[model samples]
Target: MTAHLPASGTPGADLGAAVRALPKVLLHDHLDGGLRPATVVDLAAQTGHVLPTTDPEALGRWFVESAASGSLERYLETFAHTVGVLQTADALRRVAREAVLDLAADGVVHAEERYAPEQHQRGGLSLQEVVDAVRGGLDEGMAQARSAGDDIRVTQVLCAMRQGDRADEVAALALANRDAGVVAFDLAGPEEGFPPSRHASAFRTLRDASFPVTVHAGEAAGLASIGDAVHRAGALRLGHGVRIADDVHVGPGGEVRLGRLAHWVRDRRLALEVCPSSNVQTGAARSVAEHPVTMLLRLGFEVTVSTDNRLQSGTSPSRELELLVREAGWTHDDLVAVTVAAARHAFLQEDERRALVDRIVRPAVSPGTARPGRHRA
Candidate 1:
């Protein structure tokens, strides 16, 4: 079902307020990609990691500008500084804690933040230590959020860099920590050369263990990569799967047809973690208005909006939804639909997903209470 706001005229300020008040579910946030600008400066100073600028605001702007280079490869190069300072357990904990708090403040009720654990070993810490530290930070952030009257649940999706040869080791790490805090496994990093098939053993391990797996597919690559992710790697979800639109054709008669792969994804309801701003920055789409997410959503794909890299995109879930409302003509209904879809497809068990929708999402977006601008909670 779709929802709509008043059609005549709505101020942007009012629209932004309603979007912020709606409870959000985030499935594609990146821990290392969403660090606070000031925190990055402080951590860089402590670790002696040189940055483009020492000033927090300038560093933040530099990240946005560098990531907006319109090439995914160049966009990813901005991560070196973030990964550079995040080599210590203490650094990971601080970043994780801040990520939860920041998401909660942005009105996210449930979130799955991911990071590549193998990337944090420069400080001589074990993979287990990295997971432990991040889990500790998530716990700490949740506790603090509760004290402040914010209800939020954050968990980890451990990722193995597809370009690296440690997929097997990282898969083992995810399985070992599954019961503790890790909820799923992921294959991340460049997708052009390092296809999901390269991590076949890791996916096998995860599938045998019945652990959830999401792959960074259909972003920098095309249909073949996404095909490999779903068919070969057994991915349950696609990270930045916007490129799946390549398989969808819209005719001049206003009719739409889906290619076999697109049909498979939509028919099976494989969630697409579409981050509009990040997609635009990386040249996946021209802009939010032109992003395939809106079309895919209308076409009945289980589309979910997210802030892939909050810092790099300079976005929040609320902001992403607002962009759709203003640019792509999304209404409150579209916002709520994506939120519920995210909750439904989250890595948690079925009962937990239901509870998240009922206790968090439904109450905020319910009719008569979710009107624009006036529904601040």
Candidate 2:
């Protein structure tokens, strides 16, 4: 994380210093979203699952190239290879354990990794068994990080596919594991025809239980879907809430106008989990430079950057921040504000969240400290 001080008056120059060292808080990440290509190939071979390619590097490139089809549906086909290999308890545990270590290595202080338990049950394991396997893996990963003196905390977010009718069951699964490291609930999967309102019963149950929820909205769908997630599903945060920009307009002479939906999102301060590369791959946006994340940040919306799927999109949180700095001209203050906003809005206990802000974010931004540099293991 070598900090490169930007020349005077350069766009994003200040951000290079701040974003590099900032103790990031990640609220939206998928467990199956990130996988080492070699691990995938090995796990596939171990599980006897046939793969499109046996070579690790070729298989990795295949994922990135195949995902360039410019549609979320097409991008998701690459997951068959990953999910196919992650069926057994041992496989699930290894994946989960490695996921935590990877995030820690990437400098994530706290992360919430979501996955659908229902999807991993094809190997004759019950939903509880699946959760236990993942949890055990996470626990082992945490122990390893602690041994290495890396301060990283991880929580699980149980996702129920909006296209399925098992939302209530998934909600119950989350609640069942609430004290066992599960922090929240989510609804993921194709968002076009599957409006979040379809899962109202499950949302109602979670709300009644006083649990936090985030919905994958405004990505494949539009503002109406985001509206349903917040109004009907009670989402505390939004996953890839990029399309909310559809409601924002910029006029001549730098004047900006916000439609009803955009204004509400800004005013409510709901965290928007913006993933730049993933958005481009899914055709949600034209390119990283054209991403609305900058607009939303300038408009005072709570925006937290993320890598929706590292393997598929070929990105990391640091890389995402760097791309925004290079393309969008974000500064150190902007970077600090966004990272702090993510930490502030993380779905963790109040005291734990505060401790992270004070111990990590504050020091990383202090003027006398060394400039942000790459993580050297």
Candidate 3:
């Protein structure tokens, strides 16, 4: 392990620039939730989908403001336009391609972009077709990035909407496409009333096949939802698992005591994909500084930072780290810690993750690693 670096001089413009230049790994980004504003405008025009405004700039503002509603249910409603335009294979392909390029430009070296395949079937495409289109787009973007002197590895995680009834079908689709870049299966959409146990058969099928699993839990709901994801759904990772903080108690002297559930999560080293800006918009946390991610990190839970939805949140992996440094008092060491955690917990095979940490991430953040002098400050 590299020796921890002390806090950089200041946490303003210089720090933001440094954070943006650091290499990053993303584990919880959503495909449908990260379309570029201009792309949305162009696709909506092609599909004859009406929008709040056709101008790309105003449309971007609309998404951010609409999602700013403090209710997760309301925040999700803003996706109607993004998903509406993404019904065609071409639209899905373009969005996936651009998403990869965007993440790469922001210094992300590895990303797993997820989406529910069932959502894109409204245009009469089969699930396999949808997967193929996205894979093609990712390949195109990867090739383009390499030509531009950047290298990135992007993969897919198939999601089954919890509010829908096609978990078994989605699981089968994931299994069929596993070797074709689909790395894992997940349950997304409203986490309040829908528990992962509802799709027990799907999870059992994947487990029997030795497939990896992740679940969106402890975000819109509380401990029971998280418990179901861990014990019943067998999730190797939790999407926005910030609510695990509910089970942790602090004493008058500031000593921390972990409840049984918290102990299980921490002791087992289950990674929590904490998206701070998105969490505040959904009322999951009061602010970035107050978010349980910092406390969870201090208490030894495996905590990783991510941008859950780039478009709606108006953020990237770099911007997400900048916010944490600016508001949560995170040092360079803290940023490096989360980056290492994300790489280790990514849904890759052990050798792949090890290579990513050893060859890419560690070299980027180590002391005296050459970066732009302007960013080094």
What is the C-alpha local distance difference test score of candidate 3? 0.89
**Per-residue lDDT for 89 in model 1?**
94
Candidate 1 Cα deviation (angstroms), residue 63: 0.5
> Which residue runs does candidate 1 get wrong by more than 4 Å?
1-12, 367-377
- TM-score preference between candidates 1 and 2, better one: 1
Give the Å shift of residue 256 in candidate 1: 1.0
Clashes of each: 0, 6, 0
The lDDT ranking, best first, is 3, 1, 2
lDDT of each: 0.89, 0.83, 0.89
lDDT by residue (tens digit), candidate 3, 65-120 = 98889889998998898999988888889999999999888888999999999999
TM-score of each candidate structure, all chains considered together: 0.95, 0.93, 0.96
Candidates 2 and 3 compared by TM-score, better number: 3
Give lDDT tens digits, candidate 1, residues 224-312: 99999999999899998999999999899989999999999999999999999999999999998889999999999999999999999
Q: Is candidate 2 or candidate 3 better by lDDT?
A: 3
**Could you say which candidate leads in lDDT?**
3
Clashing pairs in 1: none
Q: Write the per-residue lDDT of candidate 2 for residues 1-377, one digit (tens) a residue.
A: 44543432464445544454556777777888688899998998888888889898998888988987899999988889888888889988998899888877666778888899999988998999999999999989988987776677888999999889999999999999999999999999999999989988899999999999999998988989999998999998999999999898888887889999888888988999888889999899988888888888888899988888888877777778778777777666666777788888888888877877887876776432442233435
